[model samples]
Target: MPRRDSPGPESWETLFTGISHLVTPAPGPQRGPAMRELTVVEDAALLVQGGLVAWVGPRRDAPRTPSTRDLGGVAVVPGLVDPHTHAVWAGDRLADFEARLAGVPYEEMLARGGGIRSTVRATAAAPMEELVQLARPRLEALARSGATTVEVKSGYGLDFEAEVRMLRAVRELQSLLSVTLLPTLLIHVPPETGRAAYVQAVCAELIPQVAGEGLAVAVDVFCEREAFTVGETRAILSAARGHDLGVKLHADQFHALGGVELACDLGALSVDHLEASGPAQIVALAASETVATVLPGVTLHLGLPAAPARALIDAGACVAVGTDLNPGSSPLFNAGLALALAVRLNGLTPAEALTAGTVNAAAALGLRDRGALAAGQRADFLALHSPDWRDLVYTLGASPVRDVFVGGERISL
Candidate 1:
């Protein structure tokens, strides 16, 4: 008689063992105090077949398989997911950095032919191939920092042609990268002139083209005093919804401006940059299903107040974290640093920070398949150098990732 753990001709591809600890959240977006409830199995093993997790438990009960790879006693957790990033852009923001250091405000820089506009000019001038080349290293750096899935947004290209090129460049990058990429069309800001015309073109021309081509999975709008108003954001998001695209918003970064309320009312997948959010915005987010995504890197770089993450989470809202990797405002590259910063700056516990960076961040992207270490989920996970998974957030200015595996295959860093 065969042992109970026998494969029984199921054709298992790989059985991974030698894990000191396997820590992961449940298979869905965790909210409130539940976010701290991670499942930890000691002396664990994971079975993989067809690039998906087939089974996960103690090695003693592991199924008999033809192949096995020992992981050398490392802690395994779900791969980090970055739901918000403006990773594709050309030109440098060194001058903008200098100006900011000299006490020039960000909005002032935007008003004076700098900030996003400066990158817009450079990114618009670059060919699609050049865009791909420029963005590759940034994505790779994020991947090295333990992000297996990253949402890349095209906001630097505010015009129709340039935006299309940026999305196409993202498509090109998908072929070159091991990390899963989700594309987003970001309506960054109003043009210096033709604000109404630009909004109309985005709704009528760009959104339709992008949706028809399946270039982006979601449409994001920068809803702020310096960007699109709440009304314009509603119009654009409505157009995107009509075309069957998901919606998100850059809300309440520098001003409340009702963007949070609007985003919740419109059912956006997530509302990001809540540095300027208050108790009312917290109440709205807690009442809705929209993920409250906080970018701690922005606070660290811009010297802004941290978002009301503690309040949001305490009010029963689902909170997530990201790097907001960009040129002008946030030059952060490491997703691990983003998680660490969330703990220190955003008032999240280490476990909550990990949940924010993993499953909740995946929720922010409207992804349901790759954020947890469960059967039937994608085999994307990280091996940490220490047995304690909290070190991923505890170790600041350094990475605790020992190895990264996507689809059960170890990726070279």
Candidate 2:
């Protein structure tokens, strides 16, 4: 099969044997693990055509094809999915990091207009092309680190024109990069707009405009103590649903103020930043389809309490992991290292951590065919130079990814 790069299916093509190990992100739990499954095949081979896997089995039992490219003994895994991110923004937060290291708190920094507002002012003042150029290197870095799919949000641009500009930049990046971009309209919290009117504007004006024009696929709200209130979040999300946009939430990052419960109640695709989430919210998430996206990079960067990942996973919640890559919070984009941090800081198993970044993350973003290696899934994956999968997490802060392929097309980094 000829490998395809986009999300949807197309004409068929085929790939012949040369796979050392095929690590399918299949669900491993009996009660349905966060993702579907991970089927491991040693000395395996894959048949790729039309950007999809037509057949996968041991190399000895591989089917013949017209175009077969030998990959030697490289270990293969599905393309990583980063479901939660604030990767597109202006300005830098290195000073905030230094302050935090000097015993300053994130809440304290926010109170002094050093956190999100810093980025807000810089982003609003920046030209859209400049923002795209600044953001392009970040996406290229992530793609080199083996992330094939990622979500970009527009929280820094709080006004209508700026918001449209950010979304348009995202579309431009989509055309420019090999990675798939999932744009989100983040109804940010500005100092000017009051709670009621801001909510009305986002729901009544921004959501409809964004959804109607197909500029964004999802709507996000930061439902926290310093951000939008629970009621305001609900209104924004409700209007987004009416506009047929998927919903996600920046829930319980700094406080447990019913944001997780609200996300579950409104059927959000995922709830991120459960750093301050309570037991009730964990239970609610475990009983729902909404994925719990843990951002270990944010915890590491801000020096805050890590999310209660062990509790959520043990309670049967679908857990995904991401680099909350942004200027103010998590500014890095190495998903493999992020997975390593997830395992060490949050008590996740290596296998579970890998699944969090791959399959569960795809499910979190409402994507179906790109997170795993199966008969019909996309031929998007990475060829790791390491023999052991744990080596990826073991050698943190390093690049073990030797090659990357999206839809059977080799990406030359």
Candidate 3:
């Protein structure tokens, strides 16, 4: 009989041994205490073949393979899954950041055309090639920081032509980068015209066009005081679903709106931005199937109240963390540092943060293949410089990642 957890009939193609610790976050959907119950295997090894994890166990029983690598006691963990980001946009918002730093309120900055609108104008004017060029470096940095998958949004381009251009740019970026891009059509802020008219356009025109052409897999909305109302958001999401697109929402970021209820009611895949959510919303989200994807980068950068991650977890919600990479609020792409912020500001332990950024985030993205090291999962992972995995969070500013592999292919940064 084959030894337990040993490589089987499928010959291992790539063997990695001498790992001090291997963080799998395995047996998917570990909730509450289980999330903290890390699946750390010491003196472990992982075997891969055909771009999937074949077996993970002790090196003594590991099968022979054509390619084998020894890590020399370095730690290994699942590659990060950044479930929410505005990844493709043109222009900079340094002015807005500086203004916010100088006592200018966020709303005031938006009104003065220094926030997302500035990027909206610039992205609309830019060609698709320019958008791709701008996002290439930022995306490369995230790959270097150990992110195997990223969810990109199109919100800066509110109009039909601009939205198409933005999504097309993301299309090009997918081919250019090693990281897997999950594109989302985000209904950012309402258009400059009347909110009613803008909602009509999105519902009747944009969603159908995007979904019909298979341009995006999901549709997202910003439901806030500065964005659409709950009723408007409902219409937009409904139309998206009718077009057979999944739904997500930016809810309760600035107010205690009914957006959370709407998202849960519609069975949206994930509800992001919970800075303004309260105990009731937390309980509701915990009971729902939807994911609570908190963006610590946004809260830390904007000086807003951190999302109640502890409450969400205590209530048994499936919580995931993201960098919310964008030009205005959170100009971030490093998922390693984002995980550190999740630990520091969101009240999660290092193990919990690792689980959040990997397995839980993959669920938020509706991707079941690449977040963990197990049989049939994609061979995406990172080798860290330190033997202890906590160094990824402890050393906040530094990237502890030494090597990144996606689909058994090493990414050279």
Q: Quick one: best TM-score, which candidate?
A: 1
Query: Which clashing pairs does model 3 show?
Result: none
Q: For model 1, how does the per-residue alpha-carbon lDDT over 73-191 read when each residue is reduced to its tens digit? A: 98999999999999999999998899999999777987887887899999999999999999999998999899999999999987789999999999999988888999999999789
lDDT of 3 by residue, 1-413 (tens): 10112323444487999899898787455566767877788889898887788899877778877778888899999989899988788889988878878999877987898888899999999999999989888888888888889898999987889998888888889877777888899999887777798899889999898988778999999999888999999999999999989999999998979999888999998999899999889988988988899899988888899999988988888889999999877888799999899888999988889889998898887777878888889988989999998888888667899888887667777
Candidate closest to the true structure, highest lDDT = 1
TM-score for candidate 1, residues paired by index: 0.96
Q: What is each predicted model's overall lDDT from 0 to 1?
A: 0.91, 0.81, 0.86
Q: Whole-model lDDT for model 2 versus the true structure?
A: 0.81
Using alpha carbons, what is the TM-score of model 3? Answer: 0.95
Per-model TM-score versus the true fold: 0.96, 0.93, 0.95
lDDT agreement of model 3 with the native: 0.86
Candidate 2 per-residue C-alpha lDDT over 318-404 given as tens digits, one digit per residue, 9 for 90 to 100: 898999888877877787778889999888887788788887888888887777778778787888887555666677767978777
Model 1 lDDT-worst window of ten:
1-10
* Cα RMSD to the true fold for all candidates: 4.7, 3.0, 4.7
